[model samples]
Target chain A: MVKRGAASCLLALALPAGAAEFNAALMVAPEVDTPNTASPYYVGPPLVPDRASRQDLELRLREGGFNVQETLRWQTIRDRTPEQHGIANQFYYDGELGDGLGWTAGKKLMSWGVGFGFKPLDVVQRENRRLVNRPALVGAPVLAVERFTADEAWTVAWTHPGRGEGSDDFRDASLALRWYRLSAGGDDLHAVARLSHRRGLEAGVGATRVIGEEWSIYGAALYERRTRRLMNMLVGNGGTLAAADPMSEQVGGGGTKAVAGAQWTGASGWSTLAEAWYDADAYSRAQWQRLDALTASQHALAGIAPAAAIAGNVAWSSQAYLTPNLLRENLLLRLGYDDRDGFRPYAELLATPRDGGRVWTIGAAFEGNRQRLALGLRQAGGADGSAYARAPIRRAAWAEWRLALF
Target chain B: MSRRLAALALAVALPASAAENVAALLKQADAFRLPAESVRVETQVELYKNGALDKERLYTVYVKPGRRSLVLMKSPSEIGQKVLMLADQFWLLMPESQRPLRITASQKLLGEASTGDIASMTWSEDYDGVVEDEVDCPVPPPNLPEATAPPKPRRCLHLDLAQARSGVTYARIELYLEKSIKLPIKADLYVGSGKRAKEAWYVPKPIEGQQRIMAMLLLDDIQPNRRTVVHYRSIVPKAAPDEFFNPAALVRNSLSGW
Candidate 1:
């Protein structure tokens, strides 16, 4: 169906248009991955793989003179320990039809507008890169808004993932339309209202005001009634089900949760992100209580004497599971230097305290016009056993080489 | 006594005639007042590094004045594939990536003498200061006085041209005005910020219904690091619809092939 739809659209457009121009770029990347432990799947965090190897081939094309873009990625993983192989596939497509109407369907990062609800991507060497290796494909419907403004954009169709597989399978789905208008005091007001379905029924509303050229603030709130299966996926342990068994038992509760947060960014390339949310376990309504979590992140580019920068982020989350009191704390520090000659060097560190355990990671990345190299060492150990360690004491090293392709 | 009186009168009239001629030439150069309607120009640029040709550029330009100009590159597409010129703005449309970029007024060095150190250049503004006698020109040409060597192919006017009226004027220029036309054929560009460190060549073409002339080549090839050159291949004075200059026209009227 996907192939036929794309082919027919091209054929129809090619049939008798009086000489319109079209161009495209084809990018292919082959990647390798290694994971720790028996599970070949690695989502968030890094340096957990005991020994695994995976190669990925991805192709990205921007056709129709850059108005249409499509990407397809196929990856296969071979777990040395489990002696098993798994495949991860992804596809993304975004099309702009001139006057604002557009479409986006794909596996992509789900950042709810202002890097709050979900931020799975990071910028590296002036390019947006993945923070988490695992990706979810959530097909999105796009609606254009503020057509003539510089900041005009289209809101993605869905927020939460839905059920099933392929592009349409999302755990949460959302449809939103955003428009910017003038406020009473001449400030710009951007607002969005989205009907998003997570496991159950979820909806959200958000607005932002540009106080001045240097400052802008935004806030959003979400109300959700999640499905039992979705809750089970989040809280349930890894297990296999009996084949052809319809009455198989699944774990986790189903209930509603409300979330809210605000963010502020400045023109000096300084951005401070802070968000606090309370999740009300709708599945376990009998034990319903408010759980609070907050995250603070700061990023700034400095051109001072060293011509480097200092960026840090700290996050804390209250216990979400009832069986055990688990408080999550995370800290990340990044320092880097850049110059016009195309030489850039950076160091990164991440420390996370989960339950009653601690994990720390330190790494450095260097890049230049002709070469790119990265090395990192990670150690995670604690009294309750290592959160990512084989036994509570874990250490690992990794390095990579990049080849430029025409 | 009659002979002495004749000599005195001759001396007086000679300076007066020379001064008038200088004034007329200045006026002719200043005739580049209103913008042209449409112009087509072919240019050849030779890049010189330490007195040697390193690279070259050959391109054609189409200009609808106050509206837009399109540069169709003929050679070295790797250099500048296609360039679009508009009033007060110009964009370089690359064939490889095919992206349009907004450039500042300094890029005018690569186009018709619209704006530059020569923006205010005219017949009147440049030929001021001391008016010399016909003998001052190199031998054998109206503007070429007989002071320099004939073996040399070109001649120049070395004059101290400080603006007595305003501070925005250039000081001390060694000008090479074409012998036939009393206009600056080429000039040594300078500033208080820098020396007479850059050389520019002006290829001239006679414009219809206009005095003085139009620029055919505005090449700034002396500075190797800042390789800025403009070639005005053909220029025709013709009017255009004002709407053609609007941003709406940018997307409405796509590039020729596109």
Candidate 2:
């Protein structure tokens, strides 16, 4: 049903774009993963795909005040049936009421925030940064009114309209406001506020200031009234394993998220960035240790308990790895170089210091004429007992090629 | 004794008088590129390697007062990308991210063609220099990538310029302008390290009975075999709204119509 609706919407994109700008591109991406059999919670067939081949046709159109951006995709994972999907990346309209005031209505890819590794004031989009070979983003539904000036701008938006709490962050309805000011000395300042049922009141401020010609410093912090995370009921409990599912959602009181970073670039086309971020929603060291204890105890009951039940519980625990970050505190260091001739290469290291877990990745992209190619490789490991050391996916590599059709 | 006093006074006045003349000359030289304070310039850049065309890209630049410029990428591969420069501050909006990102001076130098070279057309606002010498206009070499006209003997003004403000693409430039008309002809571009980086030559054409710069040729010193030619397709007076230059406004696509 979703595919049918998306296909119908995509058909409209091909309709006469007379006097309107039109562009399309085709992309083919393939990813390979190496699963760790030594992982205590590794799940085979149903839980993971060892390899995937994906192809997409991306189209874009702009006419007057309306624009459409969408991608049609087909992918096959391992031996599974090939899946077909489509996404409306951005379908929006902009109108002016005069007097420097404007309104936007539709699905829009909008983000009012700062920071490289993480954006604290991204209340509407709430994107997870630093994913390898990620697809184009789909915008959130928004109805917004904006006021603008030469150096300042204000926006009030109702995002994910008509949806209520209990939905995911992207789908939850919320009222958010973003205020931006360009300081006299050329610094960028941002403040944001959001009122949502799920997270309650959320507010944050961010700033980016350039020092000299090569160095830039930025930081942002957010305060949330409430935060929730899904955790296993077996954690902190004496039960070795439950016949039924033990996963439950836990809500906590006030929480905070913040990030600080600096970047430096040299005239030689070499750049480096160092960033540190804290996300309270991620599991803490204590939480990971407790979960680890439970997993160990469950393995001890393998003979006593039903083999399927034990395997099921362990598999459920692996979901912990689904989150972007495994620990509360993360530090990242990256170095990149652009040859100024369309080739860029970079390598980065992410460390979860509290648990001594680390992940490293290296990537490069070369763009020529109407063609672009990118390749990347990632690995996760650190201390022997760290969460990353026990991750099911030990290594992954991906490559993608894109060509503009017109 | 009266003759000695007269000579001393002339020397003192000559330096100060020459300083003012250079400022006026620079302003006049700027006019060859900009007919008005705010205008839209359609530009196409072609990169050549060893005299062979390598790549091409198109851009539309809206130049407003107060050292602000908004450049839109009009090519197929880079469509929907924009760079907004407000004085020393800059922001980039890419279609994939859909976010207004604050970019440093070095970040603006990324890509094959620097955004600064594409958008920035006037140099009087960013430079203050002195008239150094009067010399013959340097003719293009026969081995140049573009076709050259017959050489003609013409006097030119040699001006040595230094950056008056940060964020400008080049730190210092030794420029040569047609002495009689103050039309820019050629320049030696230098980086912050005081090292020669690129050499530029300007080509002027008749526009509505007035001579205006229509193309610029760049020869890179670092990459000896590479040359870039920037062609100005059109220039029309257009006063884009001030709101369009705001950093937060970089994400808005409605400006495509403007």
User: What DockQ score does model 2 reach against the true complex?
Assistant: 0.71
Candidate 1, residue A367: how far the Cα is off, in Å: 4.6
Cα lDDT tens digits for candidate 1, B44-71:
5444334444445565555453335565
For candidate 1, what is the lDDT? 0.34
Best by the lDDT measure:
2
Q: Which stretches of candidate 1 lie over 4 Å from their true place?
A: A1-49, A65-112, A116-170, A178-193, A199-331, A351-400, B1-258
lDDT of 2 by residue, A125-210 (tens): 88888677788888988999999998899999999888787367778899999999988888889999999988989999999999
> Model 2, residue B95: what's the lDDT?
86
**What's the true lDDT of residue B245 in model 1?**
32
True contacts kept of 2: 0.74
Error of 2 at A299 (Å): 2.2
Candidate 2 ranges with C-alpha deviation above 4 Å: A1-16, B1-20
Clashes (candidate 2): 0
